[model samples]
Target: MVDYQIKIENCNSIDCADILIKKGSLNIKYGPNGLGKSTIARAIVSQARNDGSLELLAPFKGRGKAGAGQPKVSGIDGIASALVFDEGYVNQFAFQQDEVVKNSFDIFIKTAEYEKTMLEIEALFAGIKKAFSDNVEIEQTTKDLKELRDAFGKTNADGSIAKSSKLLKAYGSGNKIENIPEVLKPFESFIKSQDPSKWIGWQIKGNEFLKLGDTCPYCSTALPDGPQKDIPLAVAKEYDANAIAHLNTLKAVIERLGKYFSPKGQENLEKITKAKLELTAPEKSFLSGLKTDIEALIAMLEGLRTISFYSLRDVDEIADKIRLLKIDLGMTEKLDSVETRKVTEPINAQLEELIKQVGALKGSINKHKAKIKKAIEENQDSINSFLKSAGYKYSVVIIPEPDSYKMKLLHKDLAGHIDSASKHLSYGEKNAFALVLFMHQVLSDNPDIIVLDDPISSFDKNKKFAILHELFRGKASLRDRTTLMLTHDIEPAIDVIKSKASAFQGASPSATFLSSKGGIVTEVQIKPDEIHTFAKICTEILSAPGDTLIKSIYLRRYFEIMDNVGLAYNLLASLFKKRANPTVQSATESRDMTGSEKSQAVAEIKKHIAEFDYDALVNTVSDDNAMKAKFFATEVGYEKIQLFRIIRGKHEDDVISKFINESYHIENEYVMQLNPHKFEGVPEYVVDECSRLLKTA
Candidate 1:
């Protein structure tokens, strides 16, 4: 394995972080909550994709400055591509409608082998594609097909015409223009001209003014006769300008494309346009049937021109489809244009070529079908199994598409498939499912590096370990890849590197504690031996050099853990409440701790701290001035918390008192807390709250 040092500078909270990551290993960066782990994940991803968003990571102190500090990531040249599972990735890709993940087909199916087989099949169909391209008539043939298809409306069926049909709007029962009336025969030349729709519109506009009076509304001439009144009624009886314009457009299209139609089709169309009245029912049926024929021809031609592996999935079916492209020879015979013969001749030849090649195409596709099928089934089963084991009632099924596959999410209580997974899934469920899917995606892509930034910290211990095992400890998992898992919770590191190390044999897991100070981040290797129980940690600290009050705090915790809460625990707790040699008062009697009780507690405390003196520890915590001085002088967050606890003894402020109580008792039996070796384990905000409360006092 090669070790690479990744140096990041001036990015977010990290000023400089020189981290060593080993290729082909699972490297975990473990730290407390605010050590810039997510920022590092984003920075590395930004550089790997070369998306130019790395400048957005410049630290807030250096923002809006010209050339002040440029965020840079070095030593990642070997990482050509990386898949990171972060909060942003989860929100963007997981819990999509109709599927658990947005491009599930690419992650679960389409391997390098599948793509290669598809390319071979495409090459086999190249002959048919080239024939269509070489013939220059194919473009016009498509246009001719579209022109006839538009004349019959959407369904191309024998029924009442749709209101939106171009043919219906132009030449329906009341829409068409018939012969001119005898009253307007004087202007027959203008009415029968090449363009009469505009002139008809002008005449109709002039007729509207005749309603004003018996006199002429336009030129102020007298019109008291009956014949002039009949002029307005005749003008209003004609078709509107839009209907006339549509009729003109239809006639022009038919004139250019009619030669391609059969004799019966051309005759029926001419009679419809030339008739002086509405068409008969038989005539409408003829046009609808003709429309169906034209639509089928267009579909056949277009389908054959672009054959691929998806088209030839079933050999017999595609062979039938290709043979159907051969139209009747009589249709071509009526056309005088050379383009018709050019198109029909090559189509017949390619029909033969396509029918002959179907067997070979089927063989090529079948060669890879087993592998692709297995991949799809395994992916579906893997995700569903994860959901089951992790207490999620949802499952995924990979449905096949024409050229790919789709993975749809299903719920046990819901009907059919869920179309909106994001709505049904909780926030944690979404995050968990996204993490597992991301692991599968990393396996599919086989990128150089995989980064999981604080992925499983949101889960409980049971689910956290379940997800970790699924991600790094299976046959088809990210076991030996170069993976970086950054987390604030120590559970993953404890489980992967220590508790369950044998479970993940090939993972090559290792961890480092990340800590930041003054915008500079650093890491220290956390050996398995360094992770200890809280009781052992308390003992280790009590044995070292430190303040007496801090040692008493650890002693109190040890007594609580050891169940020795009778004399020693209560006495130390009383001292913590700012009382020295405390008294116990109940409904019965009030009494001070006698010399014998003090000696007994002192003796028990000295077992852990050899120099422990009861009076000295009590006196150290009782003096508020000395404890406040220690709180200001100390930089360690845990120490600050303890000193604040001593300084704010029995104060009536419930908020600060509650915070101190929780912080004091947070280290329980099950928690795997890191030793604060030169770094603060508690958050700065907790210590700041303590400092703020004390300063007011």
Candidate 2:
């Protein structure tokens, strides 16, 4: 794999060394503990996970703590400088020492067994409780249903057939149709033992009455003299007498029968009424209780359904209640096997078995406790063989117990005898043994990386170095995979590097010192060469005084001379005051002019001087020492001469054209020059005007 390097600038106290890390076997970093050497390593790891520059890796004892500030990282593809792990990386290979390791195997076995037992026992208790509750509920429900059904029988209060028969008899012949004789046969037998006379006018109808029913028998009158006989005399006589006697007798018999059966009917009605009344309250009470019970049962069942176990005791109770209700309602035929008390046996049997299994697991755990110690002892030879290749050779045994396991360390010589002193290894030695066990377990499953944090803390220099070497170089160790070792010592790191292992320094002393003072990384590259160049430039610029350049021009009279000769001399004349000259002062007074005329003349003189031929004037004034005095005098005189000539002569166009052409050449020359001197040079405004005049010409 390609090696990756980290570069950080102005991050922390790192005034001296910005880091460069290399990747590969036995990678070493040599730095003091407080420096950001560790920070840099963490930063690389952080950058691998995220974006931007690497930040100072903060040291955290555990996960999620911030370690160092942000560090700038470079060279790693797709990794920016901003990412950092404040906390040291999570140590994937963890080892327990002292008591925890001593009792681990026993604890493991016991905890597992206890958990199994608890689950089974809890399930059994729940089932037993449910069965008890269901049985109670079913018994109560059956009793209530039976009472309610019995009440149903009592509450029927309608009178018997005797009362109905009495009412019919009171209505006399209206109640007696021709078929009454056949209908009354059963009644006749019911009352056969009683006197027929006591039954009064009760009689069977005969055909003899119909045979002689042509006349009204009571009056003994002949039938009406018509084709149809309205009535038969004998039948009418019999019907009339019998109807009166029959009504009287039926009324008497009904009255007698009512007296006899009335008490019994009342007694029976009262029994029914009392039964109904008794049943009504209890039935309602039972139903209300049942509803409440059922609702409670349903709630319980619903709760139980949500639990791990599928069976519910309340459901069984409900089923039993339903069966009882079915029997009470004469619907027992509708009750099925599934709806009865069939499940109790199977559920009880399963619960018993579950309890037995829980007991068995507890026994197994106890048995394993002793066996695990023996097993670990037996396996010690194999473990030592494995550790021997990894540079350490101590027999470590883990014995399972009820609460926790006991860990024992022994040399090969201890053999079959249990050595009490062997269990008392130092903290570091215990840690080593635990580490071996952990590594053995972990290496069984393939892993990509192994991170160790201060694992050799308690060991001496030699031992620490030895362990470090073995961890990194051992045959069983990861060859191609990454192994991150975190430590405060530089010896192991230097040793690794001297052995030609790939190494990067972390935690430089300067890093912490510089980071204490706030520093920032800017975008600008402030190189040593660039700084030197900038300083030299500044010194040269500052060396020359500003006044010297100004004095050079004034002492030489460069501007004054250029003005006297150039046509556009007004440009320079406007800028500088001419020196007061004795000859020129006297010459100015000779002009016969008022104060205003003198001012105008001086202004006109200056204007003409501004337009003087600069190049021609410069060539004429060859002596450098007397140039300023000569140029000023000549410029004033030349302006007077030009003004006088212009006023007197008629050659204005020719003179103006000659001045414009000269000005054009000077202006053109200025444009071609890279850096034209300003005061001694043609002004851009004057040059533009001269160009315009030339173009117009």
Candidate 3:
């Protein structure tokens, strides 16, 4: 810790913060979310930045505090510089769309000048050899295999099939029907037996053959005289009833099923068949399986069409076949799934060959270490080694190249393509990357003072632990720099404060509380936390003097483990009470007396808010009406229902979003200004009274 004394007057939140931060001491400052823990940390950095040498942010001079002409910020003398990781730093380096930070580079003698004499270049290489004697093997390969895989065309199928090519050019091409249905088989047999001419109806002659009266119309020829004589042309109609009726029915069914065999429908079937073949293994199997039913339906239609008119067979199958086809068609997807297949082999083979060639080059060329070009090709070896040692799950390395160095994050995706560090990294991974570089720069520089404002804001639990261990576990890394870590998170804050030691030079830590109200900051004293068991250290620090804003948050953390929300809310209500007027205070106390526990609580909160009586906010949509619309029906529908929306309280939400829209507000927004810690020459009583008011919460 770079020992520095601090005194603030009319700063962002600190009305006056006079404290001596000893050197090499683990000093921690914590508060509740939205209460500007970052403010105090940045204020310290701003003081260090004021020495006129560092191009840094100016200290905060309380803009809202009245009678604040100029701030009297002091006690920052030998502070050379400050390494701060605040919002500004995160915005500039962590999440912008820019080239990812260099993590690795190479060793080579590459000249920047476009043109040079052969002898001049030879002299340069000779000079490199003279300076560096150790041979270093630098492998040139693709940086990110995963990204390269994406760069390869998305299309995979060969598209070389003759049918696909021909069908696309002409829609009608290759259009054909499937197998004729079994239902048509009997009709085909009946059609072959047709001998309608042999029927007695053929012999019938004369108008109606006497309306087919008692006599056999064919034998009417026996009556040679009158109308019946001389073999009257009017013969009998023998088979007309059964054979003609069946034939007509067959014809009707055939017409109904004919659409599948039509030119248009046949063209579509052909497309389906071609698509089936083009699909990936699974999709091809699925489409092929559907062909059985399709073929059976077509066969049924064909059988119906070929039915004989003279003889009858079962045409009962037509309707059933048509129904089956309709059912199948309805179930079929509008678009068939023809997944992709690799048209070409993976590029791994080529990459492997290139790697081999590089190996060969090493044998031919003399192995020698060269002056690494920091300007042109940055050396990320330091960072890469640190990250790898820290258990990063990638074969990260840096290699020298012609103009710039290659940062190979050597890990392939399922498709065997290496992943890009920049192009498509996840949010968590990006956070880790940015933080690693930030720490590397800070520790490598060995700055006198380090101010990290919620550095692990985007980190996971495991990552948070890893960083904490690295910073506080040993004295070797931070032996020279004074570290002041600021966080609203209780766990980490506990860790830093518990590690407090006079071996401040060693592995010990100290802490302070920065409570704020209406954007004015004040440091309060409860008790230096009693030395307690490691398990109880968090509770101890939380007990230290600070605003109820922080204490309420700490209580919430306790409730998470304790599972006593009622107690947590009661405490939270107390914190709100600190800022609430008498009416609002009375409202918070009106919890459920009998049946109206949660409902009463909500009404009281809403009622207190309504007292503000902002017409615009009141006219806004009603949370009650919205609650009824979204969830009331659900409650009635279920057998059991929860009485309270236990998660609906203002701060219960994990995602820190939105202002609570209450007259009593907690200040989360922060501002930075220069010339912090300005001590004003006010009477002791006035300044003392003001300080009491600031810490009263």
Question: Candidate 1 at residue 373, lDDT?
Answer: 80
What is the alpha-carbon lDDT for the whole of candidate 3?
A: 0.39
The best candidate in terms of lDDT = 1
Provide backbone clash counts, one per model. 0, 58, 55
- Count of clashing pairs, candidate 2: 58
Q: Write the per-residue lDDT of candidate 3 for residues 285-326, one digit (tens) a residue.
A: 332333333344334323222222111112233323323322
What are the candidates' C-alpha RMSDs? 3.8, 34.9, 27.6
What C-alpha lDDT does candidate 1 achieve relative to the native structure? 0.76
- Write model 2 residue lDDT over 340-454, tens digit each, in one string: 3342343344345444454443444344434544445544544565446545545556643332445555556667423443245555665565554444333443333343444
Per-model TM-score versus the true fold: 0.88, 0.27, 0.37
Candidate 3, residue 413: lDDT = 33
For residue 286, model 3's alpha carbon misses the true position, in angstroms, by: 69
Q: After superposition, how far is residue 390 of candidate 2 from its true place, in Å?
A: 10
Per-residue lDDT of model 1, residues 409-441, tens digit only? 888998888888889889899998898889878
